[model samples]
Target chain A: MKAAVIVFPGSNCDRDLAVALEKSSGKAPIMLWHRETEVPQDLDLIAVPGGFSYGDYLRSGAMAAHSPVMREVKRMAEKGVRVLGVCNGFQILTEAGLLPGALMRNRDLKFICRDVHLKVENTDTAFTGPYTKGQVVRFPVAHHDGNFFADDELLKRIEGNGQVAFRYAAADGTVSDATNINGSRNNIAGIVNEKGTVLGMMPHPERLIEPKLGGADGKPMFDALVEALS
Target chain B: MKAKVHVTLKNGVLDPQGKAIQHALGSLGFSGVDDVRQGKYIELDLAETDAAKAREAVERMCKELLANTVIENYAISIEG
Candidate 1:
């Protein structure tokens, strides 16, 4: 799979995401800067990595979302190119209108950095095809504005369409209040679009692809994308 | 002419910074603080004179830089 990782001014995780994609797909992905108005032709996947893009000024992901490259990203997503946005990338996707809902500040008014347990709510999407429904996975979340909010009707629409891909869960794969990091409504941790081609998640899966770092659960997500596209 | 654009999170959206300010005020013995919502005010000095053009410019600035419309809304007012 020919993938491209979008890089903005403050994108700190571009290398991490690139390494993860290279290892999983056995092909080094292209690194595209935010100022470029075009994506690589015939690209199968585009990954937007996490970071304090544009110094998080005005709002997190606000400035980066308006970057010239996002116009191409939006165009590709509409054409069914697979897109995965992690952490600040998620915030960017929402700001760009490629996804619904907004990521707000944590309810506790503090930055949360910890390993959070998540439930695989739907494994049928292009991003989660390697996981099983109800499976538990651990991914690290480090952010200040990770609280996800949407209107009641939109939430129901997303849930009813089985677009919710992951939810916070207890160690035994049970939904619980203790695992609800950032107090996101209904413990939402990740979601995919109705077409299953675009995904946005809060956790840093790119940081956990190796066992030496901590866990290898994130490998399957990248692997699944490669397999489905290649 | 100058225009000021005020961007604020919509009502019912969680305002952590505002909450922190409210708590700080309470700790400092300030009472009657019913609520607090943090926002941004951006002043733009434009060369355009037409009110509609100025308003349009400010609106574009808000959408393109001053605010994230997904979570926040903005209002623009022109000043002499």
Candidate 2:
């Protein structure tokens, strides 16, 4: 499967994402810089990785969202190419209007870096098909502005469309408020677009792909994408 | 003409920097302060003479780069 990882200034996770994609798809994905106005022709997947793009200037992902590469990313997403955004990438997607809601500062006003438990709320999307609905997994999240915010109407629309892919869960696998790392409405950690072609999440699945890295729960996320395209 | 564009977070959006400023003010013997909402002021020196055109240009600048319309609001004031 042909894939590409869009790289922006201050994006530190590009290589990690590229490695994960290569291992899963059995082919090295192309690395596209943010200044490029177009993506490679016929790309099966596009990934926007995590980091403090533009030094998190103005707001997280705000400046990076306007980078030249984003226009092409938007066009590609609209054409039904599978797009995945993780952490700051997720913030960029929201800022770019590919997803709804704003990622506000963590409610606690502190940077949180740790493994978080999440439940697979929906497994039917191209990104989450490898997991079963209601299964629990653990992934690491390190972010300063990961709190997701959306109006009630938008939240309802997202929920009604089954866009929620993962929800924060307690260590015992129970969906509870106490386990929510950030004060995201409805305990949401990840979501997909209505068409299920685009996925964005605050957790760093790329960091958890290897057992030596702490857990292998993230392997399935990449596996699902590769399987969907292959 | 020059214009100063002020950009601020919307009412419902959380402002951590503003909150910190408010707390610091409270500790510094500034009482009865209802709230402190911090914002950015960007001064621009433009050669445009028409006020209407200047405002339009500033508005475009705010929308395109100076501000994020989803969470922040911006206003432009021009002076000779």
Winner by lDDT: 1
User: Residues A140-187, candidate 1, lDDT per residue (tens digit)?
Assistant: 999998888887888999899998899988889888667787878889
The pairs that clash in candidate 1 are none
Runs in model 1 deviating more than 4 A are: none
lDDT of 1 at A192: 87
lDDT of each: 0.90, 0.89
True contacts kept of each: 0.78, 0.33
Every model's DockQ = 0.71, 0.49
Alpha-carbon lDDT of model 1: 0.90
lDDT by residue (tens digit), candidate 1, B11-36: 87778889899999999999999999
Q: In DockQ, how does model 2 score against the reference complex? A: 0.49
Q: On a 0 to 100 scale, what is the lDDT of residue A53 in model 1? A: 98
Span of ten consecutive residues with least summed lDDT in model 2 chain A: A171-180
TM-score for predicted model 2 compared with the true structure? 0.93
